[model samples]
Target chain A: MTVSIVVVSHSENIADGAAELAAQMAPDVLVLTAGGTADGRIGTSLEKVLAALDHAAGGDGTVILTDLGSAVMTAESALEFAEDPAGVLLADAPLVEGLVAASVAAQGGADVQAVKRAAEAVRGPSQNSGPPPQREVSEGSVTGQGPDFTGDFELINQAGMHARPAAKIAGGLSALDAEVTVNGVDGASMTALMTLAAGKGSVLHVEARGVDAERAVNYVGGLVQAGFGEP
Target chain B: MVLDVNWAVKWLTLCAQAMAEHRVELIELDRAIGDSDHGENMDRGFQAVLDKLAEAPPATPGAALKLAAMTLMSKVGGAAGPLYGTAFLRAAGTMGDAAEIDPAGWAAAVSAARDGIVARGKAEPGDKTMVDAWAPAADAAKAAADTGGPEVLSVLVAAAEAAEAGAVATDPLVARKGRASYLGERSAGHRDPGAASSALILRAAVGAAA
Candidate 1:
């Protein structure tokens, strides 16, 4: 079974809509929504969140995405009262983007922690002001000290690097033991990959490091060559 | 007056009464810097607490507080729901199966409640949040409890007074947490609805004993 997801939002529409959007990308994963109060108010309810957590307890694990400050508090309060709090985690990421990334990761069979990371990774460098300087990779560095694997593949899909393709590559790569980058952006970040705006026929330069480096490079290459299974 | 299950029940009943009486005032306070639902949420939450208490009366003070915690968290539809719910839950945890609370036990329970609010909201004292009232009240209860006497009324009064003062103190401070923080400097010159409600709840404890 895959990891489950819970979306908490002040507005019922937001929670339901977010879960619905995420489900489209990861139909196999369970995405639950605990939004609004029991009396049909525009705020979150701990009871609803706790009930959602109870339902999600049957899965491998549960990750929560909250919309606002009080929604976060309500989710935490639910965890405090949950029967199995340890198996559930709260991801500090934007609701819609994080839910989508987390659902994709869970669909790809990533474990709980990896799923959380995939969700958080959506907040890439641009969002994090003054990110730590990256380790420089000189041009034409092909030695053992350089990247374990690297490849360039031209996008052939009519949709190019869209949400689905980015999600697919990011989701699959998140489960691997590698640090991969596509066009200088974090490869495991769907938002980062999509930021490239790499259209049809635009080449994608991939770099990888770690034990799954070769697998990571081949994974992206295969998806690109297949046009991400799209027209 | 013994701080027992009866006292707990009375305290919660008074809290519900106070919420109903001060609902509009709280709504106006919240409207200035928050979403303007604190009064309605707290009133509904405590009403639910009353219903639960009547349906299944708890045997101990802790059990009563625990029931309130669950009820408030479920019925209150705003940030106050979780914040106050967690405070009551942690306080209940401290009380455990005990039927009555001594002065020291009361102090510890209040402290536990404050810590839970801090842990859940991640707010510190002077953040223009409920923690402002809770922190000082915890401190006052602890001090009063340590006075080497069994004056339970004094301890309750001390907490209530300190909490009231804390609520007043929020009137001049710009909010550093919660939705009010969005207003930045504009949040000052207004009382924090959470702090105001916290004071009212603590004051109700005194009324229960009196």
Candidate 2:
């Protein structure tokens, strides 16, 4: 069973919309929304949060992403009062981005803690920042203790390294047992990849290590070569 | 008079009345630095507490407070919901299965409630939040209980008076937490809506005892 996600927001649309977007990226992950009050107002409801937790109880685990001040408080209160709070984790991350990252991680069979880490790691850098720290080994096979596989591929898609392509690459890489970095950012992080801001024809240097290292390299190569199923 | 389940219910009812009466003033206070929904949210939450009380009559003071806690958390629909809900829930936890609360027990309950607010809101006394009122009220209750005299009315009165003074004390300080904190220095000069409501609630407790 994969880890599940719960989105808590003051506005029903925000919670549901974020959940929907995350679900689209991670079809296998269970994304639940506990938004708005019982009377359908723009406020969180403890009953809704409790009910969502109950529904997600039997899963591997549940990670909650909340929006705004009171939503965090409400989610914490629900956890405090929950019958079995052991498997539930509340992530202190932005609602939409955190939910999507958590969902992708959950979809890739990450454990509850890893899923939370994925969500929280989204906050490492805001939308515009320098490239994230990457474990850059070298360009080629070093004295043999190096990446299992490495490759260089040019972006063929007109849009280049955008959100959808980044999600596809990150989602696929996360499922592998390999650690991969492209252009000096965590390859398993969608937002991190988007921050690369690589335009069309920009060459991407990929390095990977682990059992699925070859597959990870080939995965990025194939996706980039195919233009990420785009025109 | 021993504080029992009936007194608990009446205290909650009086809290509702007070919230309804001061709704506009709270709205104005919040309008100055907050989102301006504290009054409406509290009134609606306590109204839900009243409905829940009617639906399921609690057997003891703790049960009543627990019921109110759950209801307020569910119905308030704002930060106040969780804040007040936690306060009531912690107080209920301290009361345990006791059917009647002695003066010392009442003092302990108020202190627990204050702790709950601090833990939930992460606000200190000078933060211009409900903790301002709750902290002094809890201290006053404890002091009154420690005096070792007839304490039923004195404990409630002491708490109410301290809470009122604490609420007033928030007027000149810049908000250090909550939505008002976003206003920075501009948040000064306005009484905190949460502190004001807290004083009103403690005052209602006195009315119930009287």
Candidate 3:
């Protein structure tokens, strides 16, 4: 069983360092890195990264970790080139976490499919708290959280919480003293979970478990179904 | 005989050539369901890889390849850089300082490359990606190689063709993986960028072998 890693970051130092670290720890583990030369350097296109990753995985599957934003896209693109990409996963998990996952996945007789599923579980985006309360995902591998939640409100508008509705929700949430955590649906981060980039008929989980949990959750919920502010 | 430093260089050159040729078409496909840079990114990366191969010609297949991998990860941007880089590097590792490759050695090297791609990408046969092309291509190439058919040529051609067809097959897929997932139902109509490039690489393989 072989293991490989792909790290994408705009920072050349980061990309180089990370690649070095991965190589040091897992010398046998194939590592391929691609990115700009500096801080302001533009990262490579996600498409090219995908091809490179295919080379890494050979024919089995691979584990990928990204710096931010389209880094995930780049990882996803790599999966496209893999043979059993199901074994491929984007390590949102700490670098160590991803390495451990890859090792275990490789040893456990886990095909790229199993690795892909488990890794995706970690890479899967979080949900957001919003008007509609439901979220849909291909599978339930997504995990992790960012920040906390605050309050809620019954949605009261006709059009519901679209971008236009965001001002009210943001304003209401912003007004609260407490920091709010909004999940899109099914405990995923709709805030930017990649999967939730969709528009219209979207539902948000919208958790407000912090100091103003009840109030914030309710406020956001209300703003969601209520169509922001439009009559 | 399988291949040597010359074989390795030639094979990789072919890969770069294939990727360069098909890079655009792949990017167009990606634009529909993905980030739309597959072609352009790969083109940029392979061009860099070719440059590196020229600057420091490796004496052994393995040494030459490690350098290629380094170039991809460093010079190329986006996903293709790391992925293809890893494949070549890993395949080089399998070659293990070989002066030249015998049939089995070549098979092992290509298999290693395949393994590297699998480890890095983690894609499967169906998700409308290059896996569809790679899996069959690898199998077909190996079968052909054992028969004393053109080892490098058979493998590359098989891998490329299988990969391309696999990309086209993606047209009907709903994309269970990658940025295409963001497109959801909207992604179904397009072929996968990775798969398209996979085909081009196969074409290069055939070209190189001949």
List TM-scores for all candidates, in order: 0.94, 0.90, 0.52
DockQ of each: 0.84, 0.83, 0.15
Instruction: Please list the C-alpha lDDT of all candidates, in the order they appear.
Output: 0.92, 0.90, 0.58
Q: Look at candidate 1 and give me any clashing residue pairs.
A: none
Q: Rank the candidates by TM-score, best first.
A: 1, 2, 3
lDDT of 1 by residue, B1-210 (tens): 899999999999999999999999999999999999999999999999999999999999999999999888889989898889999999999999997899999899999999999999999999999999999999999999998598799999999999999999999999999999999999999999999999999999999999
Pick by lDDT: 1 or 2, better one: 1
For model 2, the stretches where C-alpha displacement exceeds 4 angstroms are A125-149, A209-214
Name the 10 consecutive residues with the lowest summed lDDT in model 1 chain B: B147-156
Off by over 4 Å in 3: A1-41, A44-231, B147-152
Contacts from the true interface found in each model, as a fraction, amount to 1.00, 0.94, 0.20
* lDDT tens digits by residue: candidate 3, A1-231: 555566666565676677675454345546677655322356645444655576775545666766654455445544554566665666665443344334333333344434433334433344212243222322432323543443334445554444334423443443343334544432211122233343445556665433554676676666566565477
Query: Top model by DockQ, which number?
Result: 1
In terms of docking quality, how is candidate 3 classified?
incorrect
